[model samples]
Target chain A: MGKTMSEKIFERKVNHAVQPGDLVIAPIDCAMGQDGTTPLAIKSFLDMNAQSVFDHHKIFFVIDHNAPSPMESVSRLHDEMRSFAQKFGISLFDVGQGVCHELMVAKGLVVPGDLVVGADSHTCTYGALGAFATGIGSTELAVAMISGKLWFKVPETIRINLHGTLQEGVFAKDVILFIASQLKADGANYKAIEFHGPVIDRLEMDERFTISNMAVEMGAKAGLMVPDDKTFSWVKKRSKRDFESVFPDPNARYCEVVDLDCSFLTPQVALPHRVDTVKSVEELDEIPIQEAFIGTCTNGRIRDLEVATRILSGRKVHPHVRLIVAPASREIFLHALQMGWVEEIVQAGGVFVTPGCGPCVGTHQGIPGDGWNVISTANRNFKGRMGNASAFIYLASPATVAASAIEGKITDPRKYLR
Target chain B: MSWRGYAHKFGDDINTDYIISGKHKFKTLDMNELAKHVMEDIDPNFYQKIKPGDFIVAGKNFGCGSSREQAPRALLAAGIRGVLALSFARIFFRNAINCGLLVLECNTSPIQNGDEMEIDLLVGKIYDHTQGVQIEARPLPQVMIDILQEGGLVNYFKKYGSFRGV
Candidate 1:
């Protein structure tokens, strides 16, 4: 049996040996709740008649989706969440802390080889740090708050080994998008994807996060990267808090493995209805779109901003295109403004929205009407996800999305990588 | 948010966006408009077929994504009696219980889809008429039972808070 990093982490958490099919209950080290669900969870916790939260420090309640978007409806939701937080004295990040995924990693809430759970499906996003993270319901989160334990089946591990460095204009998002497109939306359900290869080794923490963040999009349990200097340096900067680090032993077992040679890889996109319905940019042309959005927890990092700015350096978005760029958080937004990436986008006539899940959740702040086709950096281009079921969504890398936003058609980022 | 119903069964990792969806995270211009979409995503015509007061028996990790209370709220609106699963997502479980939706956990469900279950939530047990199974849930605290019996936290607060809600 070739134990992958995930299996090892699971073993440590449960304090027992585990196989792919074995069921195990492990204590969730960190529990993250976003505002969309926090108020309700807090209400439930309060309703439970518990004197106080199970543990104060273990819960991270963040208001990410509607932060700074003071629509009448948005404000109501925030007000409710705020009331709950104030009542409970829970760890809350309300003031433009950024998307919970990136924010948690940057703030040192996640530790390698830890079992983390969240109220959001994207809670699996923390897997980038090699933590076993998965999404749970608010009910489970409530239980986790009170009980601090989570139940999960020991999932089969899929070993993905990549060879060759990414070509110019291609980044981690593209790589992950391609992987999801190949695996299909439900490809790796209840499975752990152990990412290996020199390509991953060279990836920066943010890039690894971009990939691991979307592992759940493939219906995966988690994605893990072996701890290296990048992981070590990233951790060192965050905390001196000491916890044991985990690594897979040499003779660990794996249920399956696949290899990809990235030397020939290029820009790819997943058309609607399914994330795995992939097509290369080279094959798509003149697919005119009404809207282009370049931001989401998946692709709204500072690096994503740099890629978009690079693509729009000397060109303006097409006249027919309505483009919106929402940074992921206040830090990213302010940093981009300080770095002038936001200006480059604005100068190109793109509307730069605030850092919440503005357009991604279809809150209608950036919604498109009937007959619209949108290209976004967010995941889940499902039908009717973005306010219009008739409308089409095309998912692409930040560079590809930026390039397409400029041209109002599907285009490769490498074509404008200069 | 208080509920009295029979339990129905389901599988694990029941995601919220999958249950109700992020689009319906808040009160909508049209409430019933989302019912069909919710059913379509989970089970088409689920709203119509699911009997009132039937407990939902599910596997583990139920309600696995987004803290969207709308999922359970939708379930309550759709006339689910209660949720019975091996486990629940943190928020969904709490929200359902808060919103007067009865959510119970049994080690395993002997009741199947059409089981005539009579659940005495106050007693924390479900009498499965069809399967002759009587499953006991991990009982909630007495105060919680009062909160549920009062039709949710709001009603409880309204009665207890001296009209602070007003």
Candidate 2:
């Protein structure tokens, strides 16, 4: 049988033909741990009594989860991470650098056809560049740091073909939310999803990143797209690394095929406590929100900011709502500032925070009050996701969030769109 | 090896966020401190109700969301001997195995809250002492068994010098 994208990537990594369900120990191109997981990984690394990391250049430590140290205890963990990074001579992306996954891709640390792993679930975000990336636990990350190699059970592939153009104000977030509704939480357990068809090809790198970032929400090991000219140019602008892109054979064997027509899709929202409980924004009743957030690894890119900015430019935030905007990285933040998107957003009563995962991870900054409702563009909507189990989180597109912020209710972005 | 515990049953899609909330993640990394808050959102008194060697029984998709190892670590610290679910999110399943916490997939519907249960790791069987019945569980692969036998991946790495059964 012809090989799928993941199978092809694994075959190349191991330098042998492989099939689904085969376990192979392959060298990892890059491995990372964020502040939330790194401390535990350091503990496990010491517990293993490892003398040194396999390679300093291949491992990274990022401090974005609880950036700037919300408290003394978190600060101590940050210090521990800094010390470990210094001792091992590994690269450290300190606070405000951005979310770990965004920094990894923005820095070009990962490329097509490479095997990558991170200690955060959204590490699957890198698959937008066609890399076979997935998330593992801190202990597993420790193993990767020591050996630069990890074993994997080659997962079967699920091919999702996206056809047609998205409607006005609908975006990659909507597409992913719609998919999540159909697939549910555990739909793609232990499997890799390869997105294909015209819609995927037409999507920009930022949109692709948003889609791939949420693959983990569907229980996918990796959500990948075939690297095309756009992907190549995007990576080339960021890094001078020589890399090869892998694609599935024409007759590739997929366990299942899902075809989605994006033309019919509308602004989607995942209600409180469950990502799979998605509905079209227009179909929902007047669900008032106390906060509207536009940020995170999922939708914190420049394009995402531009969309939110366009919606909030002249209109003030609703009296009952707080609009918070955080760019995915300092680079994106500076770019948005140059474009005047930040000023316009802030002028419209949106609060701009440091470019990191603060409110999204609920470490510090902008957490909702108890019994409040929040509309966010972040990926997951699991119970207590935003640090307050009593508060509710609704997942939507950046445009939708901005619209909702303007009205203080779950409003469709198309109403604001010209 | 066998483990006996009272089942602390829960419903479907019990994500890691519900297992341990994000608010507590930054407050402390001490497993014991985290243990006190384990499942606090789902059941406020969860930690107080379970004794040493207890089990968490739940429906489908147990331990979904995020790659936080703290979820399993906290459960282990809270004296949860094992988790029996209809299924698990992929990352959580691997994390549980890496932490040396027992995770089994079976028809957890047959298990009830506070039921006395025993799990035979070698035989892949769960005996519900309270229900007076037994159920078969999905068996772990030899590699996972090897890692779990050593009380987690770190110990397994210390003993074997590399991952085995790959």
Candidate 3:
């Protein structure tokens, strides 16, 4: 049988062929943990009575969540992370550096054909570069850090073919949301999804990152895209290391194949508390929002900011709504600043915060008040995701969030786009 | 091995945030302290109601959001013996196994809140004492059983010096 991309990647690691449902131990090329989970991982590393990490350069610790220390307790955790990283000489991305997954890709730590693991669920974001990345628990991270290897139960691949061009005002976020609504929350549990066809080919690397990042939201082990020139160009600009890309054979067997036509797709929004509860922008009643946020590992790239800035260029944020813009990384923030996207957004009444996770993880930065409704471009809208259980969060594209901020309600972005 | 517990039933897509709210994730990493507020968002009296050896029974996609280990750690600290669900999020399943928390994939429809239940790991059976029905669950792999026997991955590592059995 022809091998899928996942099987091919594992075969290279194990020096033997692997099939779905096969359990094998493979060496990890890169591993990462953020402040929220790294402290626990550090504790587990110590509890294991391990002396030192297998490789200092391969492991990374980032302090993006609760950056700048929301309180003394969080500050203590950050300090613990710093001390641990320093003692082991592991790479540490301190506060204001950006989200871990973004840094890993932007800094050249992850490349095609690498088996990357992170303590955060969105670590699957690196799959945009053809790397097989997945999230694990802190203890697993500790184990990987100490031993430099982890076991995996090879997941069957699900091929999704996207054929049509996206409609105006729709984006990669909308495409993924539409897929999520069809698949539901656990539709792809423990399975690898390979995105193919024209729509995926036309998408930029940043947009591909957004799609792969939300793969875990549907319970996928990894969301992989075949690396092409766009991927090579992006990785080449950022990474000095050579990498070999993996591709699925045309005759490879898939557990399931799904075809989606993006031509008729509209602006999609995931309602409060459930990512799968999606609706097109026009289908919803006028729901007022108190906050509109445009940032996170999911949609905080330069392209996302450009969309937000274009929509808000000659408009002002509604007096009642607060618009917060946070870049995924300091590099993106600097780039946005140089391009005047930051100043234009600010002039339009949007607030700029440090380039970190922002209020996406509910750690700090812009936690919504009680009963407030927030329209955000970040992934995951589970209850209490924004630091207030009573506050409602609606997940949408950056364009939708920008238009919503201007209207102080859930407004269709097409009108603003036109 | 056998376990007896009362089921605390939940619905589909019970995310990790509902298990242990994000508001409390950074408040403290102390599992015991976090356990006090476990499932409080879903049921305010959950912490007070659940006794040691109780089990959380839910429909599809339990523990679905965020890869935070605290979600499982909080449950383990709150004396939850195991979780019986129709399915689980991938990361949460691994996290539970690493934390030595028992998670079984079975038909949780027959299990209700306050129902007395018994699970036999060896036979992969769930006996609902309240309903007087037996549900067969998918048996866990021997490697997972070995890890659970050691009380989690950390213990497994300490005992074997590597991920040998796994």
Candidate 4:
């Protein structure tokens, strides 16, 4: 029996071959906690009464979820985080840096074959670079911070091969939404999803991140794409960290294999309240929307912004709709500003929030009102997720959100795309 | 470890948001306070109705969504002895163990709402006394059960100390 990419990653981390269902103690290459979870982790660390962290450089505390301090209490949490970081000499990315996962990848902290763990579930996002990353609780993270090693039950791998080219208007967001629809919410429970084939090769690194970011919605342990030249180029431009490329064995055993042809895919939308409740843009009714949001860790990168910029270039947002644009990271925000994408989006009546996890976690910024139907490019549309249980949220691509912002309703992006 | 409780049933995909609403996340960090609102959205009286040593039984993918440990923490605070589900999200399972909450993956829903159940973690047995059914759940690894026996990972670390880091 051969090994999958994640299996190989665990093997490298543990210095031995691992199979699915095997429980092993693997050395952690990187561990992180965000503002939403870090305070608890810090508390756990203190409760453990440990003198110091295992490795200062390998651990990180990011203040992104409630970036810029949503309130005085939250600011106090920030102060606590800073004090903890300073006390332990751990890396701390303050407010406005970016979401933790994005910062980790952009800063070159996540290399191929690295064993990464964070307190946030989307920590699986780093698996896009071929690293075996998964989310754990704050206590587990605190344990990692104290000991630098954690136990893992190596997960079975489910291979998904994409063959056909993504049709126009059908962005990477659509591909992931389509996959989620097929898998339902719990389809991949406790399994790692590995993407393969030419279509995955064609997706940009940012696009791959978008796919892996949503893997949690399908209950996957990790969503992995083997490192290729594209991944190498992205990492090379970001950091000078030395790394060895990782790939699965030719006969790597998979629990199951799913074939997805992107050619037939259209811009997909996850209906209100459930990610798996998906419908194509054409098949859905044109329901009016009170708000449209185009940003988040899932679809707030430079390329996504450019897509929004292209759709909103010559037009203004509808007077009735409130459109919010949030760049995933400050680097992406600066790049958008330099490229004039920010200016174009602002001129088209899109309000820019801070370059953090804006409105995605729903703890801060641009929350929708009661009974309002809003379209967003964020990953989850779970009830009460956007700070309001009465409000409805629809998930789609940045282009679809931008077009809907202009139309003040749920409109397909293909009509707006040239 | 062993537990005897009545089942409080829930359906599939009971996400963390429903477990402990984000609306109350910033209000306080008190686990007991958050327990007052556990599953408030799904069952407005869930917190009020839950008794000490109650067991939460659910369909597949229980505790799915954002890795807010509060979900499991709230259950522990609310005196939920264990959660028996067809499956669970990965983070929730780990969090449950760390928080000293028991989670068993049952191959079937052997117990329904209000049914009396007893679980023996050491023996990997679930006895649905009300339904007169017996189910075998995957036994937890000895390491994890040891940690749980120590009242979660923090206590385990306190007693055993931690691994030296590089």
Candidate 5:
């Protein structure tokens, strides 16, 4: 049988042909732990009585989730992380560096065909570059740090072929939300999801990252797209790292095949408390929103900011709603600033937060109040996710969020777009 | 590999956010302190109610959302014996196992709250002493069982030096 993309990645890691269900301790190309999970990993690594990290250069520690050290306690964690990084000579990204997933790709730390692991679930975002990446626990990260290898049960691949073209108003966020609606939260549990077909070819690098970033919402181990000319060219601008393009064979065995037609898709939103509870933007009741956020590893790229800016340039945000804009990384932040997107966003009454996780993780900066309603472009809408259990969070595309911020309600982006 | 405890039953989609609220995140690294606030948002009395050596039985998608290892570590610190659910998110499953916490998959609806339950890891059987019934659960693979036997991956690594099987 022909090998799936996941199988191909694993085969290279193990240095042998492997099939689904095979458990192998494969060498990892990169290992990461963000601020929220790194402290624990450091403790575990010490608890294991390890003398030093297996590969100092290959491991990364990012301080993005609670950057600026929201509190003294969080600052202490950062202090410990700094100490750990210094002692082992590992790369450490301090506050304002941006989210780890974004920084990893922006810095060209992750290349195609690499097996990457992180302590944060959204680490799967790296797969947008065709890398086989997944999230594990802090303890597992500790083990990988010590040995540079960990065990993985090679998962069966599920083919999700996206056909047709996305309408102007429908963003990559909408496409992922629609897919999650069909797959439910646990639909792809323990499986590798591979996106193919013509629609994928048209998606930009940032758009591809947005889709792969949410694949974990449906329980996918990894979400990947084949690296084509666009990928090569975009990555070329960032780094000259030599990476072999990996793709699935034509006859690859698939556990299931799901075909998504992008032509009929509309702007989508996920309601309160569950990502899978998705609906078309027009079908929702007229809900008033108190806050609108536009940033995260999912939709915090320059392209996403441009979309929000393009819609908000000539309009002012409703006086009742607070719009917060966060860039994914320092590089993206500067890029957006230079391109005048930040000026347009601010003129529209959008509050620009630091280039870190910020409200996306509920750490600080623009947390919602009791019983308040929020429209955000970030992934996940679980209860109390924004630091208030009584508050409601709605997930939508950046365009939709920008439009709703202007109307003070859940307004569809298509209505405001030119 | 066997465990016996009272059932602490919960409903479906009991996400990691509810297991240990984000409010507590980065507040402290002490798992014991974290255990004191486990499930504080969902059930305010959860920490006070749960005793050491208790088992959590829940519906589908237990420990879903956010790949925080604290979710599993908090339970372990609180002395939870194991978790039995219809299913689990992939990351949580790995986290729980890495923490030396037992996670089994089975239809947990029939397991009532406060029921005395015993699980035989070797036999893949769950015996409800309170209900006088037995449910067959999918057994863990040998690799997982061995890891649990070694008291999680850290200990396993300590004992064996490096992981086997490339």
Candidate 6:
């Protein structure tokens, strides 16, 4: 009853505690920017008479959506962003070292218990590190850029406790997709989610990120994880900058706590129209996949590729299916190369693309033609979220996607897991 | 918070991109400049010019994408006095109040454009400002009404910083 993770987080880095009906100004620990929205945010800041950023140290920018390939206008936008960062002294992640959320995790920009606001909705991904991170509009982002403060309504939180070990071949993506299917997109409307359980301890940083990344698909403001050894070690290694550990008080009370027997979860996928339209791979009959893309902030990680490579070692993509593999980051790309997963993916008659937000935003690469049925590794499969509004994007775990890519349809990943 | 403008009606699920496209997401570009082309993507003539004091009626998830405070900034600047939606996207709802834009969440959907609305923002009612037009919408919670009355969350904080750590 005293404090939840949300209250505790606000209590620390903020100027004060967050009570009902109380509006407080808190210093933003990290401000994330991406190419699609950051340029406009910076432009608005300039228009508002902000000569320089209030504090560059707290600001961060990344060019994730259109990286590795800079179309003319896109290149200009990047240049504009570079100039904005230079003018305001904000550190820019131009190389797009990784997906913005993954990059923030890897770069140590987000620490457990830090309050982060990102121009992109997925900024809520940092809540995986135990921070109260939320997404904001570019206009509000600009305000945060100049004022270092914004207002928030303390969202009602629903706590999910994962109690058992995960089934093999079922990674964090499946766990989240299953959760979304249960909650339905609007079930948790205007709520914050705190994910806790024993299984969370085993998930890698990127895996935890994948869980928190898709939280927005459930209509949640953010998804949070409590600080653990993973949080401490991650902050120490990446941030190289010192950070304090924050947690919910021992007697904290949650509005509701939903317990899960993760061992009960299998490879899951969201059909169409909503992330909540969940169906297990085995439940569907003869569902042929037109395409399979394995990457995004959701499942684009070293482990994801490693699991996929094992499944695709000697197999070729179905003659009718086009399979695309994108590493989550340059670091992951280089790591994949060294580990031979890159070669495995290529030898399987699949296309391995660059490390950016391509298929996810339907921008750079992997464009889905109309009526295309794509089982993707990205977050949302909302109507028209991909290429054509009519294109049916089904969200799934990397393993399920890999198995389906081989079978040319949605197949249960358990066939290959053992 | 003084309610001055007339009402404009629009259905919900009005995304930020719909409010202002990604390409046009720059600040200091006031609402009048933005409202000029409001819904140009959806309806090319929406913002050529609009009535004052009109409200936007949204179906569900109004202001759903990009947490940029600009969506409401442009709407409020353009001509909208308040937004009445069956539901509101969480972030946008916060930003609207924080930035002093009025957003009212009303249940009972299917808001038609022709239904003229009279909104009592203080009381959280959206009666047909138009005579002979009857529409249904749920009023807001009292706590939300109070926050709005103080001219947005920040102003409320300024007057009573007690609820938050100041």
lDDT of 2 at B94: 93
lDDT of 2 by residue, B65-139 (tens): 889999999999999999999999989999999999999999998888999999999999999998999999998
lDDT of 1 at A143: 59
> For candidate 4, lDDT tens digit of each residue in B46-93?
988888999999999999999998889999999899999999988898
Clashing pairs in 5: none
DockQ-better candidate, 1 vs 4: 4
* TM-score of each model, paired residue for residue: 0.79, 0.99, 0.99, 0.97, 0.98, 0.86
- TM-score (chain A only) for the predictions, listed in order: 0.95, 0.99, 0.99, 0.99, 0.99, 0.96
TM-score of chain A of 1: 0.95
Residue A356's C-alpha lDDT in candidate 3? 87
lDDT of 4 by residue, A111-196 (tens): 88788999999999998999888999888989999889988889998999988998888898999999999999998889999988
Give a tens-digit lDDT track for model 1, residues A1-418.
6577888888888788888766566777878888666655655566565455557778888877766654677677677767766766767787467778877887888878778888776777777777888776555566577667755668888888989988888788778888887775556766888888988998888788888878777667788878888887888798666767788777878777788887778888888655678788888767988799888778888888888998887789999899898887788899999998888899998898767676776665577778788998887776666755567889888898888888888888897875
Under CAPRI classification, how is model 1 graded?
incorrect
Error of 4 at B85 (Å): 0.6
Off by over 4 Å in 1: A69-74, B1-19, B28-37, B40-69, B80-166
Error of 5 at A210 (Å): 0.3
- Per-residue accuracy of model 2 over A1-418 as CA lDDT, tens digit each: 8999899999988999999999899889999999999999999999999999999999999998888788999999999999999999999999889888889999989999999999999999999999999999999999999999988999999999999999888999999999999999999989999999898898999999999999999899999999999999889988878998998899999999999999999999999889999999889999999999999999999899999988999989999998988889999999999999989998899998888985987767888899999999999877678878789999999999999999989998897887
What TM-score does chain B get in every candidate?
0.83, 0.98, 0.96, 0.94, 0.95, 0.76
lDDT of 5 by residue, A1-418 (tens): 8999999999998899899989898999999999999999998898889998889989999999888877999999999999999999999999899999998888888888999999999999988899999999898899999989988999998899999988889989999999999999988999999989888898899999999999999999999989998888878888777888798999999999999899999999999989999999989999999999999999999889988989999789999999999899998989998999889889889999889887977779888999999999999888878888889999999999999999999999997776
**Top of the candidates by DockQ:** 2
TM-score of 3: 0.99
* Candidate 3 positional error at A325, Å: 1.1
C-alpha lDDT of residue B11 in model 1: 60
Quote the B-chain TM-score, candidate 3. 0.96
- Residue-level lDDT of model 3, residues A1-418, one tens digit each, is 8988899999999999889999899999989999889899998999999999999999999988788787999888899999999999998999899989889999999999999999999999999899999999999999999999999999999999998999888999999999999888998999999999999999999999999999988999999999999999999998999899999998999999999899999999999899999999999999999999999999999899999999999899999999998899999999999999989999999998888889888867788999999999999999888888889999999999999999999999998888
Whole-structure CA lDDT of model 4: 0.88
Which segments of model 5 are wrong by more than 4 Å?
A: none
Error of 1 at B33 (Å): 9.5
Model 4 compared with the native: what TM-score?
0.97
